[model samples]
Target chain A: MSTFAEYAISAMLIIGGVFTLIGAIGLARLPDFYTRLHGPTKATTVGVGAIVISSVIYFSTLGRGIGIEEILITAFLFMTAPISANFLAKAAMHLEVRTSEKTRGQTWDQ
Target chain B: MMLTALYITIAMVTLAALLNVYRLIKGPDAPDRILALDTLYINAIALIILLGITLKTRMYLESALLIAVMGFVGTVAMAKYLKRGSVIE
Candidate 1:
C-alpha cells in the first residue's frame, strides 16, 4: 500500500546514506587536508542534496506545497561547501605545510 | 518501512559524525580541524532534518535551518581567522 512518494523518499534516503558513507570513508582515509577536502566537499554536497530532495518529496506528498525551504537550503549548501573548502585549502597552503612529495614539482601555488 | 529508513539514516549520519571526529583528532593543523568541524555541523543539520521527518514534527526543521545558517557563518569566520588571525580582517 505504499505510495509513490514513499518509494521515492525511501530511494532518496538510501542513496543519500550511501553518499554520506562514502564521504565519511574518504574523510577518514584521505592523507592530508588538501586530499581530505575532496571528501566532504564533493560527496556531502550530493548527499545533502539527496536528503533535501527526499524532504521535498515527503512534504509535497503531505500537501505542504513542494517544500521550497528544503530546496533553498540545498542550494545554499551547494554554494557554500566548496567556497569554505577552498578557503581552508588556501589558508593551509599559506601556512606552508609541505605538499605531498609526489606533488613537489607541480608548482601551482599562486 | 519509514522506521527502517529512519534507522538507516541515523546510522549513516552517526558514522559521518564519527569520521568528522576522527579528522578533528588527527588533524595536523588548526584549519584542518576547523574544516572537519564545518563538515560535522553540515551532517548534523542533515541529521536534524531526518529526525524531524521520523518524529513527524515540523519544529526540527527550524533548528536545521538555524544550524545551516550558523554553521556557514562559523566556518567563514574560522577561515577568515585562519587566514589573517582575525575573523574581521
Candidate 2:
C-alpha cells in the first residue's frame, strides 16, 4: 500500500519477468536438448521464485498476513524443481538424446 | 505503480509462455517437450499469482500451490517413464 512497498514489488516483478523471458528464449534457441535443459531448471525457477516472493511481500503487507501460502509454494518449488531437472537429464542420458558437439563428459560408444 | 508493473510482468511472462509453446511444438526429443511442459506450468503459476495480486485477494494461492505439487509429480512421472519405460515400476 505504501509507495516504498509498491516500488519494491514493481522492481521484483520486472526482474522476475526479465529472467523468465530469458529462460524461455534459451529453451527455444539452445542448440541441443541437453543444453536446453539448463533454461527451465535454473533460470525459470529463479524467475518464478522471484515472482512468488514478490507476491509474499505484496500480500503480507496488505492484510494480517497471507504469506504462508506463498512461502509454501516457494519452498516446494525450490525443493522439487532441481530434483525433477536432474531426473529429466538422467532420462535424456538414458535415452541417448543427442548432445551438442562441444559438450564434454558424454559417454563414448562401447 | 504496482498495477503498471503487474501489467508489464504479465505481458513478459505471456510472451515467455508463447516461446515455451513454440519449443514444445518444435522440440526434437521427448525430453525437450517434457521440459517445455515443465516450464509452461511454472509460467502458468506465475500468471495465477499475478492475477491474485491484481484482484487484491488471496484466493488464487491455493490453486497455485496445487499446480506446483501436481506439476512436479507429472514431470517426475514422465521423466521416470522415459528412463524406465514405466512410471510405476
The i-RMS of every model, in angstroms, reads 1.2, 0.7
Q: TM-score of every model? A: 0.93, 0.96
Q: lDDT tens digits, residues B1-89, model 2? A: 88899999999999999999999999788999999999999999999998998998888989999999999999999999998889996
Distance from true position, residue A36, model 1, in Å? Answer: 0.5
Report lDDT (CA) for all predictions.
Answer: 0.81, 0.90
lDDT of 2: 0.90
Give me the displacement of residue B63 in model 2, in angstroms: 0.6
Provide the clashing-pair count of each candidate structure.
Answer: 0, 0
User: Per-residue CA lDDT of candidate 1, range A1-110, in tens?
Assistant: 25777888988988887888788788888776777788989898799889888887777777767776787788888889988887888788767765555554542446
Model 2 C-alpha lDDT per residue in residues A9-100, reported as the tens digit of each score: 99999999999999999999999987888888889888988998889889878875758888898889889988998888888888889888
Model 1 spans > 4 angstroms off? A104-110
Per-residue C-alpha lDDT of model 1 across residues B26-66, encoded as one tens digit per residue: 88788779878988998987898788778766667777777
List the pairs of residues colliding in candidate 2: none
Worst 10 residues of 1 chain A by lDDT: A100-109
Candidate 1, DockQ score (0 to 1) = 0.70
